[model samples]
Target: MKSFSDKLLWGIIVLLAAAMAITAAVKLSPLLNPPQDISLPLNAACDLHQGPCTTSLPGGGRLEFSLEPRPIPVLRPLRLQVRATGIKADSVEVDFAGVDMKMAFNRPRLVSGKEGLFTGEATLPVCVRNKMAWQATVLVEADGQRIAVPFRFETKR
Candidate 1:
């Protein structure tokens, strides 16, 4: 037979143990399943230049590009508008694998209630023509993670 005092003490002990268990479980939950890496699909629209063409991305969180009019119009340059969200990267590099154009930019650190927007311009190789459809892939890296997004366009003479 247990005394009343013993029962009271046991009840308190049980509650304390339960609390400790809950705390431990929550602390270890994140470790058990860490965040997985993910890549988003590329978002872009194609436009042809009558005199001067421009592609605009809203929310300042998108990339916009344009090409200059050419006499031969064989190859044209690509202008890029890049935006960063929830990141604090010191630098960023844009590489056009399909074409010979490559560029790098210094991105401003991410701030509270505001995302960093980067805009740059580059010229495509002169050999690129409308007959050959090309793919331009953009790689954005921040916080030790890299994301690749692709855009495609054809030049029409």
Candidate 2:
């Protein structure tokens, strides 16, 4: 036979254990089986000199990408800017990579500026060849979801 206080203490301990177990399961479920990501292709042909290029995002939103200075020079400071519309984003980052070659360290996290605009500075690495193709992947985080938009272009020396 147990006292009333002992029974109440045991009951509280059981409830707390149950709550912790539920929290752990919710956090680990994603690691157990990750969700598949969908890639959205930009329809517009982006030329570095022309002006800012626009693209439609998945769901309902728009993304505008631009770079300062035409013909994108290597080993120099380049300004990368993005303007997003009809979307709520907490943060934005650009991941720069070579189309064919492997570039391990070029991704720079952009800081938000003004309204719906994010800007960052990044430098492209010089390749052995005079010409190289690069991809700038913009990652937007909104409402606990991350979306990636890729812009491809070629550079020449």
Candidate 3:
């Protein structure tokens, strides 16, 4: 009778282990399969000159802007960085609002040993007292393709 009860207990444990294994497999099956891709429409557009200080693509490109203070009071300089893939431009330019400043940057190139990555920077004049927002844009022309990115910025008064 004791042997029979011991066998029953081991059988119950084995069954429970099998059930847990099946449950785990079912829960994880979705992860093992390829996910579906979702697409969205492009709303408005960015021109050679126009929105935010920084604009990022849905894919993997990003544009960043930074402000650097100059030695002279009330004068601020801006530094812009762009990292992108699959796009190349002949030139890039930036324009500031409420200030008569137009700065240009050279074309972007891949950092060594990396593919599809580009970076460049430009400096522009800014006023801290004015606290006005600024506008910037990027134009890329390569392989008969033209892409423009617009940006806006605001500095403290």
Candidate 4:
């Protein structure tokens, strides 16, 4: 009787462990195979508040990013635009993150336009501080490669 009970306990333990492993794998698969970010090597700096800024692509193209309504404001729907001159951009997404603080995941995919142009709308969350720093990363997928273009700017509340 004792031996039988021990075997049953072991079986239950094994099942629970297997279940946990499967759950972890499912949750972490995206992190393991996330889109390639090519922003580290090429730290392209741009002031989005100003009209438009252009950055050179890795292969051999130029990417221009612009924000509508000049002087970005928080809690407003701002029009974001991207135009890729040289690269064949299939998909484009903008990821916003607070540079000085940890905020929620805010990434919006842009609608592909004619040729290499992509447009989207995004709103920045309000912060407790008077001024906040943000980093907006433009993700471009072209020729089976995901390139990340990061830009930094500050906004006041």
Candidate 5:
């Protein structure tokens, strides 16, 4: 038969083991199950209006994103272009999202051109504020999987 002190010692060890496991699980939760919406980060200083910004894809490949009409006009037909390399893509799309506020759904499927170039057009809704921040998420679909690269830009009225 186990003595009382031995039983208490075993119980304490088991409780500590459980506590350590829980702590590890809590600390590593985000790394284990990353958020699904996470996309490739774009440089904060990058100016899509001035020129195209290029970023590497998750697995492999390079994506060049750009918005047209330097200064990025609002309520006017805006041109969007993306040049991607090193991946077989089924389709490409650009989803516009307002950073400061929620706006109507605006997603445009870009037409593929020669040599992995995709182009599309869209009109941005007028914002109440003079300057509005926006995020353009480029969605690339291939082999039943989708990859997104997000670019942030601001529009001035």
Candidate 6:
């Protein structure tokens, strides 16, 4: 026995409540389960062994990675230097893996050398193929959040 206006008011209230609920979910969903993998495209033509290569990071930061010994060699110690700008990181680590092969287990924690500079030593394993593609994933931890930046490069025998 509700009047027409009363029914219309109830309908509007229901719609408003539903809209608010959807908005809340959209805002809080990321916090509930933050993204784990964030793929960053190479903004520049980078030769990892030749010189320094830079990539843009989230939150207006820049990540630069350089490998020592101009041409990267397999089964040899390689020096990796990481430089970060405009971002504060508590710790940084590098994970090296084969791009097309199932080769893992090369995560090395870098030591801080100077302000915003991290250095570490890692070696690339030889693959069956004469030329192999590798990905170096740099994990930066700050403020209880982990950001992964991957850099892809190729090596030949």
Which predicted model would earn the best TM-score?
A: 4
Lowest summed lDDT across 10 adjacent residues in model 2 is found at 30-39
Write one digit per residue (lDDT tens) for candidate 3, span 40-151.
2222343212322345544455443323332212243333444445344343333233333433332232222234323443444444355554454444333454455544
True-structure Cα RMSD, model 5: 10.5
| lDDT tens digits, residue span 1-157, model 5 | 9999999999999999999999999997754333334366666877888899998876678889888888899999998889989877778888888997998878889999988999999999999999999998888876667777778998988
TM-score of 5: 0.73
**What's the distance in Å from true for residue 15, model 3?**
99
The clash numbers for all candidates, in the given order, read 3, 0, 1, 0, 0, 0
Lowest-sum lDDT 10-residue window in model 3: 33-42
TM-score of model number 2: 0.73
* Candidate number with the higher lDDT (2 or 3): 2
lDDT of 2: 0.80
**lDDT by candidate, in order shown:** 0.47, 0.80, 0.42, 0.84, 0.84, 0.81
Those runs of model 2 whose alpha carbons end farther than 4 Å from true positions after fitting are: 1-38, 42-44
- Across 1-157, the per-residue lDDT of candidate 6 in tens digits comes to 9999999999999999999999999998764434655656644467786688888887788888888776888888989889988888777888888888979577789998777999999998888899998888788776667877777788888
Error of 6 at 127 (Å): 1.3
Native-referenced Cα lDDT, model 3: 0.42
Order of candidates by lDDT, top first? 5, 4, 6, 2, 1, 3
Better of 1 and 4 by lDDT: 4
Q: How many clashes would you count in candidate 4?
A: 0
